[model samples]
Each structure stands twice: as structure tokens, then as C-alpha cells.
Target: MSEISQAGGTLGAGDRNRSLTYIFGLMLLVGFGSPAAGLVDVPITFFLKNKLHLPAHEVANFRLVAAIPLYVGFLFGFARDRWDILGRKDRGMMMVFASVCAAAYAGFAFVPVSYPMLMAAVALSAVAWSFARAAEQGLASMAGQQLAVTGWMSVIWSMAASVPYLGAYLIGGALSQALEGRTAEQAARTLFLVAAGVMGAMALYSAWKPKFLYSHLKAEAHADRPLQDLARLFRHWPVYPALAVWFLWSFAPGSGTALQFHMQNTLHASDTQWGAWNAIFAAAFIPTYLVYGALCRRFTARTLLFWGTAVGIPQMVPLYFIHSVDQAMWAAAVIGLTGGVASAAYIDLLMRSAPKALQGTIMMTAGSLYWVAIRFGDVLGTRLYEQAGGFGACVIAITVVYALIVPVLLTVPRSLIATREGEVLPLEEPALEVGAQETLHA
Candidate 1:
């Protein structure tokens, strides 16, 4: 273990206690927050496919429209970094957005279900969710750098997100099936009401003041010039490679809506079975995440990065071979297992690349790219699946994209990966020009 981890933190003895509490608090935020943000996905997809009878491309278009807020997620993160809401920083931002999310859900609960109505509600919820996501991700990045535990934070974030998502997929599958008996309006009302309660709980959790977490945010320097900070962020080179890694990794031409449609229409898988496949895939990741948390402490990011990429490049290959629903379930597990280490390392690298006091901005910027890649990938994937060499073309494209990440990884600053545990990036301004003597502060 590094001295920083052994000593707990740079501050003092109290830093240990603060670090523990802060990490636990983040775990809670990400864990509950995942499903609260995503529980509507399966139902919405099903509603469009089964009820509205939309085509594959139309469904992808709907997802594209609904996810607009997520594509611009950095703006919300910039807002969080520069503006403290009601003087409570991330906590206030989370509470306020979570409440807005709940209200949106509540309003949708009573409204009649139509394609337009569903699109509007989902978009509105996504906007509210953008703010909450920024708050938590920013806080997690800050904690990871401050506590010198980027790898462990990666595990917490990945596992928390995966576990809740597993349950949400199963629950959402059952809920979608249950909605079949009701009128469209009644079904909308039922689903939205449940969504409202989830966001309400998230709001309540945000309202609780953890002194350690609150104090950490309070102690950090607030950005005085938002424009200058944004400019500085753009000039930062390490961020480019980090963001590229996320974009390329998430830009899966073989997955998202394409995979879903293939499993359902081509393989004749029922909604419940689709959900089970997702649950099984998520479950398969738990062990790898656990192992990664340990391995990250022992290995450098470079070591993990190379090995992860080697394993992760073939992630979509299994999907290309699956012809049956049963085979698809096995393929999902294989995909998840193959990608776990790379996914965690991707997150760890992004966290490490964040400039001091700009964790929110960088993390959220990366998030924005992630959603953009995913949505656009869906748009493109659907086309390729229909027009090109079927699903295999998408798989080949995804593999190619994953391979491109290796070249990009070479561009990351050496300073960022010099330590096993996270060594905080410089607090001082990074040198702007390439070949500058001080690319990173010592």
C-alpha cells in the first residue's frame, strides 16, 4: 500500500474517518441513484416496441431524443463546480434535482400515455437526472483523488451501479409485463408513480448531512471564474485521452438497442428472459470487480490498462455467434466478464486525469461523451444491423473501436500513472503549450 493510503489521507488522523464516511456515502448515492435514473428504460423500450409498435430505428430515435440532457451533462457539472446551490455544494444540487426528478415522475404518473407524452416525461426526467449525476460523479472523483483510492472508488462505482441495475432490469421486466392489463393511461400512471417514489427516496437520502462529506466539499476551493476554468479544462491534454477512452469504449456498435432488438425479435426471447440476461450479465461482473479492487492496489494503471484492453477487445465477439436466447444469456455473461477490468480501469483513469477542483467538470464531460457515444452508437448500430452484414458488422465495428483505444492510451500523461494508488494531480495550473518544461506539476 502507498503511504497516503496507509496514513489514510494527507490532512491528519481525522482524515481516515472522513475518508471512510465519504466513500460509504458515495457508495449509497451511486447505488440507489443508478436504478432511480434507469428503471424506466426497459418499460419505455417495451412500451414503444410492444404497445406503440414502433420500428427499431424509431425506438432508437426515441432513446436519442430522451437522452438529450445526458449528452450535454458537462454543463450541469460545470454548474455544480462553479455554483453552490443554496450554499450546500453537491448535497444541495442532489437534493434539488432529485426533487425535480420526483415531481416530473409524479406529474407523468397521472398524465395520459402517448408517444409524445412519454418522450416529454423521459426528457424532463433526464434533465433532472443530469444534475444529480453530476453531483455524485464529481464528489466521487474528488474523493478518489483526495483519498488516493481511485481503483477502489472505481470498484465501488462499478459494483454499486451494476448491482442496482441488475435488480432494476428484473423489476422493470416484471413491471412491463404487469402493465399489459391496464389502459395506456393507467399503465403510465402506475409506472410513473413507482418512479416518483424512487426519486423521492433519493431526495431524502441527499438531504441527510454527512459532516465529513460536507466539510470536504466546503474545504475545496470553489472556481471563481467559470469561463477561465472551462478554458483551462479544454487546454488540458490528459483529459483528451481520458475522454477518448470513455467515448470509444462506450461507443458500442454491437450493443444497446441493436442487441436488445436482436435478442427479442431475432432470437424470439421474451421480455422476462431479456431481463434475466441483463441480470446474469451484471451478476457476472461482481467477482471481477472484487478482484480488480485488490489488483488495482498491486498493479499500475498502465499494466491494468494493457491487460484490460487485451481481454476487453473480444467482448462483443461472443454476441456475433449467438443464435438462440439461451446462447445469448451465456454471451451476455461472457461480455460482462471480459469487460469488467477495462470498465473499472477506464473509470480509474478518468478520475485520475481530473484537474484539482475541476473533478465535476471533467467527470461530467466524460459522462456527456459517454451518453453521446451510446445514443449515437444506437442510431448507427440499428442502421448497420438492418442494412449491413447483420449483427456481425456491428460486432466488427465495436472491436475496431476498442482497438483504437490502445493508441489513445499512449497519449496520457506519465505523471498521472506514475503511482499505484492515485497521486493527486497538481493543484497548480498545468502548462498550456506542448513540450513545456512543466507538463505536470511536481
Candidate 2:
């Protein structure tokens, strides 16, 4: 077999690049299809503040409901790994999810942006996006190992996640303005219509399908023994600490929702300025991803994680002191710059630690921890901001908690640290056969 599947089936650098590019787009679209995040997030938040006059905690509550599906995304991941859609694996499921998401958003355009309606609509979108996102990650992990680009998967995936936010902040200011003149109902129709259009495009793309995705390699036999693979999730020791690290790093009280409200209400910033702050913050990461990717090629995961976390924790402290939008943007840049190493290293660890056969379950579970943390953080942070001495208190707590992440690193298994040095992770093949033969069809 070719090392990096090439034209003649011999894998080469170019083949890996091509595969990585494809996976990058796959990850980006799944993340971007998210209607209420990144650049679009500003509008969503502004809508709540303007239309409903929701306080920070109430907004956090909204986010909690929207994000709940993400917290349980492992169920969807498990389903993806366990069965093929209409007897198809990644390909069929991709189409199924894209179409549903497209319709869900389009239908949302017709609803009132009232609390109940918005909550229900966001819930549906979250569930559909979770399934699609999990399916794509499984595809990426399997294909990435095949192409030998696993080392840089985090950098590329983070790029997919943040690059859109960068553009979203830059252009999102304008996107928000485009809807500003309209009433809340009209604005919901226009904004959600745009989101619907994006998902529609995704559906069309999935319908055509990419042959290389299915052609990458044969899957392991874990499909039939789904329960066994899930059982192994606990069986692996490294997973525990890795999960703990993800949770601790993410669970900052009121970090997202409260901080956002702080920016809007206290900073007295315009929507464009807020978007600019986010845009600048995201811009800081692009170069950092390049640097992190280069570093990962040369250094060990422990080396990167240790240093990355060290720098990142202090930078977040600056947010507690910012008085103006400009100062906040500068602070955002610092935080973003320091974030690269830790972000890249964390994904590298997860990529190395996840069982190749159970990639979906493991990665999504790690991701679910992140979303779960966000849900909890949103509520906790908001509550703390309301009662625990305001924004300054939240920042101090966040800084201290992140410091705890470094020690958790001590608990990761020795085997994964070795894998991070470029050894292969043995695939956990299921004892039972996967799929009815028909489901295996390309």
C-alpha cells in the first residue's frame, strides 16, 4: 500500500496535502453551518439584547439550551460509528444531516424570534449540526491517519473553527447591519434565510459527494461491536486526564456569555466594534496556528502543552482590567497569540489518545466535554458575574482554573506520549462484523 495514497495509489506529500485540504473544508463547513456562532454570533447576541432585552444570565440560559445537544453529541457519534446510513457510512449520513439542517434553518426563518420559538429552533439546529459535525470528525480522523497528516490535524481543525470567526467578525459587522433596519421578525427572516442558504449549499455539496472520502481506506471492524468500543472509552486511562484537561480549560464561569455582555453593555461598544474585537482576536490565531503546526512537527505534546497553558492563563487576566474597546482588542490579540500552542497541543493529545476505531466516540466525547463546559460555564459565569464581584472575579477564577490544567497533564498515559512522538496507535478492531453488507457500498 502507498504511504500517502497517490495517483497510482502510492501515498505522497501532495496526496496528503490534498486530503488535508478536503478534511479542512469538511470541518470548516460543519463548524460554519452553525447559525449562531462565530461572526454570526454577534448578531444572535445583539438580537437577544435588542429584541428581548435579555440580561446576561438569561442569554446564558438560552445558550445552555442550544448547547445541550452538543453536550450529548457522543450519542450521535456512537450512532455514526455503529451503523451506516441506509447501508452507507460517512457519505449517506452526510447527505442526510446536511439536508435536514438546511431545512431546519429555512423553517426557522418563518418563526418569531420570541424566546420559546428561538429556543426550539436553536435546539433543532444544534442536534442536526452535532450529528453532522461528529460524522465529519470520524471521517477526518480515519482519513488523517491514512494520509499521515495526523500530526497537524489540530492546527487545520482549529483553522477551520477560527478562520470563519475571523471573517465573521470582519464581515459580520456588515451582516448585522444588513439586518438592523428590519424589525425583529423581519431580521430573523433575513438572517436565518442566509443561514438556510449556506446549509443548502452544504446539502448540494454532500449530494455530489467526494469519492476520495469513501476511497481513503477500509474501516476497521468496530462497527458491529459499538458497545464494546464505547466500553473501551473508560478502559483507556489517558482519556480520563485528557478529558479532565478539556473540561477544566473550558469551564470558566460566565466566560462567553457574561464577557460578551460586558463588552456590549459596559464597554459601550458598537456592533461593528465588537465584531472588530472578535475579528482581531481571531486574526491573532492564524499565524499562531502556522507556528504551532511547525512546532508540533518538531516537539513533543508535553513540551507544547506545558508552555502553551503557562502563557495562556495570564493573558486571560487582562480582560478583567480592560476599560475600552481598543484595550479589549489588544488584550484579545495577546490571548489569541498565546492560545496557539495549547490549542494545537490539546488536539494533538486527543488525536493521539483516541482509539483509531473509536475515533468518533473519543473525539466527540472530548468535544462534548468542551460543550458541556461551555453550557456550565455560561450559567456559572453569568451567575458569578451577577453575584461574585463582577467581571474581575470571573477572570481571576478562570486564570486560576487554567493553572490546574497543567498538573492534569501528569495523568495522561505514557503510551500516548510515545504516540505523540510519531508511533502508531493500534486500531481497536471490533470482534463483531460491522454493517449489513449492503451498507458497505460506496
Candidate 3:
């Protein structure tokens, strides 16, 4: 018997404490990183819309810059996995990313805020965020195993991300109102500095708490060739269907600038009203987060997707008819309830399929899939809104595209699906026998 099994009933005093600390370390990096994203986004949006007087399309252009770096998530994953650290790999990178994030934000504080300047600053910040995010997600995946509850990991991450959205809406709206003229610039500068300070603190904590914070990496020592390792994944059948899910579900043809313009121009919402709608949408995620957490433990990935996607895609229908701000808020709240469920389910399934050795690569690549879909959706949504029948027309097209997720979901093999009934780790051969039926010789 393993010593662990022999000593199962009791833990040493130090061992017990260290294990507890380890749990916290796994969650801390992502928790902080998720909320920080809200801080960056809300301020940036208000800066462009209220200060610079740019249209929704222009704002989306800025978002494009912020999004582009995320497409290379595999690179970040490769770097994290390939490098050896003096301490621990994930912890070392967390500290480095936090420092870089701080520096980037600090630089943003001094730069002149113009179209080009805003794009550059936001893009730099996005790169920093990408690294920090990759590190946190890696830690989160490890933490899930330690906690013996993967569902809660998704819940915590989603909830943590939501908190900032809610706060940024209420607080950011207030900041917009209070900080006028020169103060608007000053407010942005202050927010940037605050972000820098927070990241600096994160670095300091990771450095000091390496004993607690470092991840217990379970990946094999090294691969002979990185490209071949990746190529092997591409040859795997499940990856294609999973990517299709992201692309189809997120391929909303009438969102991005279209939806924004609808809310601002058509609904005629003020800044605070617009912000309130967002805050309410985020607030609705609380209950859904809890419910999804429980559901993940009880249900299979395919089942989760069927029910989740069914309910979630239709939620957009309300947006088509939303002529008033009240209607808009209600729509957001309704979508929030189901949207959270669908999103968490998607994440749960993806993680279940992640290769043990390439956990970082698979997870980050999954993230990249989501963003790539969003970017394409944004471009399509904008053009559709302009070319089609404005908001309603675009919504209709998006709804149809979203429904196509059902067909895409069907294409994924049952062998690839993960559940409480069975796990689907990426290294496992789901392609033959278990993944595919054995063919008898004729």
C-alpha cells in the first residue's frame, strides 16, 4: 500500500496546514484576475463612448485590438509548459505576469488617450491579462482536483468574473458622473494605477507564499517535439466538434456594435441606465452559478449542452422585441439565468477532455476558440445590423445561427463526452473501442 493510503486516517500538523494553503493558492490567482478584467473593460468602454464620442463600431474596433492577442493562447500555454522554474512553474509565471500587468497599466496611465493610443494601451493590457489568465486557469484546473469538485471551480470562476462586471457597472457609472472634464482623464489614470497596485500585490503574495501557491504539476517531464505533440491533438477527432460548438454558439450575427447601438440609440438609454442593464445581467448569474455547480456533478456533458443550449439560444429572442429599457433589463436578466448554465457546462466539458500533459495547452486553446468566435461574430453582427433590418433583423439571424449549435453538438462522439458516469481525459484513446465501435473483418 502507498504510504498515503496507510496513513489515510491522520495527517501531520504541518501537512494539514500546507494542504489547506495549497487549496487557496490554486484559486487565488484566477479569482483576482477575473475581477480585474471587469475593472479594465468598464472604464475603457466609458472612456471611448463618453469621452472620445466614438460610435459603437469604433468601440468594437478597440475591443478587436484587445481580443487579437487571445488568439495566440496556445503560445502562452506552450511557454508555461516548456519552461522550468527555480521554484514552481505556475507560481513563477503568476508572479511574472502580475508584475507585467502592473507595468502595462502604469504605462497606460501616462499615455495620451486617443484612438491609436487607446488601442495600443488596451492591447498591451490585454497581453498582460492573457498571461495572467493562462496562469490562473492552469492553477484553477489543478485546484479542482485538490478540492475533488470540478463543478465548483467553474462556478467560482464565473461568479468571480461576474462580481467585477456588476461592480464596474455601478461604480464605473458613478465614476463617469463624478469625474468630469480633466477629472475623466484623471479617473482613468487612477483606475489604471489601482489596477497596477492590485497586480503588484498579487506578485508580492505569490513570491512570499510560494510554499502555498505553487501548483503540483502532473504533466509528464517533457515531450520529444512540441509540434508533434500539438499535431497529435489535431488528429484527435473530438477537438473538431468542440471547436464547432464554440463557433456556432458564439457566432451571433447581430451582436457587438449592433446590440450596443440598439440599446443606446433605439432604446435611448442613458449611460447610467445602460450600465444598470449590465449590472442586472451580471447579478442574475448568482443563482445560475449555484445551480450549474450542482448540475455539473449530476449530469453528463451532452445532457447539459442539450438543455442549456435549448434554453439559452431562445433567450436572445426577447432582445428582438425589447423596445424599452425595462424590457432590455428583463431580457438581460433572463439570459443571465440560462447563459451562465450553458457557459459553465461548455467549460466543464472542455476541461474534461483536456490532456493531462497538455492541460494548459488545451484549456487555453479552448479559450482561444471562444474569442475567435466572438471576434468573427462581432464583425458579422456589425455588418448584418447595417445591411439587414437593423436590430430585429440581426437578432433573427443570430438566433438561427445559435440554434445550429444543436446540429454541431450532435456531431461530437458520445465517447468524447465527460460526465459523473465517466471521465474523458484527453490522453485516453476515445477514438477506438471506447471512442469508436470495433469493425469486424468481412
Number of the predicted model whose lDDT against the real structure is largest: 1
- Clash pairs of candidate 2? 4-11, 5-11, 87-439, 253-381, 254-381
Sorted on lDDT, best first, the list reads: 1, 2, 3
Give the whole-model CA lDDT for all candidates, comma-separated.
Answer: 0.77, 0.72, 0.64
Position 34, candidate 1: lDDT? 39
Pick by TM-score: which candidate is best? 2
* TM of each candidate vs. truth: 0.90, 0.91, 0.84
Global lDDT for candidate 3?
A: 0.64
lDDT tens readout by residue for model 3, 62-129: 67667788778777776665554544556677778888988888988887666777677667776776
For 160-219, candidate 2 gives per-residue lDDT tens digits of: 878777776766676676677778888777767766776666666655444444444555
Compare candidates 1 and 2 on lDDT and give the better one.
1
Ranked by lDDT, the better of candidates 2 and 3 is: 2
Residue 22, candidate 3: alpha-carbon lDDT:
49
lDDT of 1 by residue, 116-217 (tens): 998888888888877887888887887677667788788878887787678767987888887788788887787777777877777787777654433333
Candidate 3 weakest ten by summed lDDT: 433-442
Reference-based lDDT, residue 441, model 2: 65
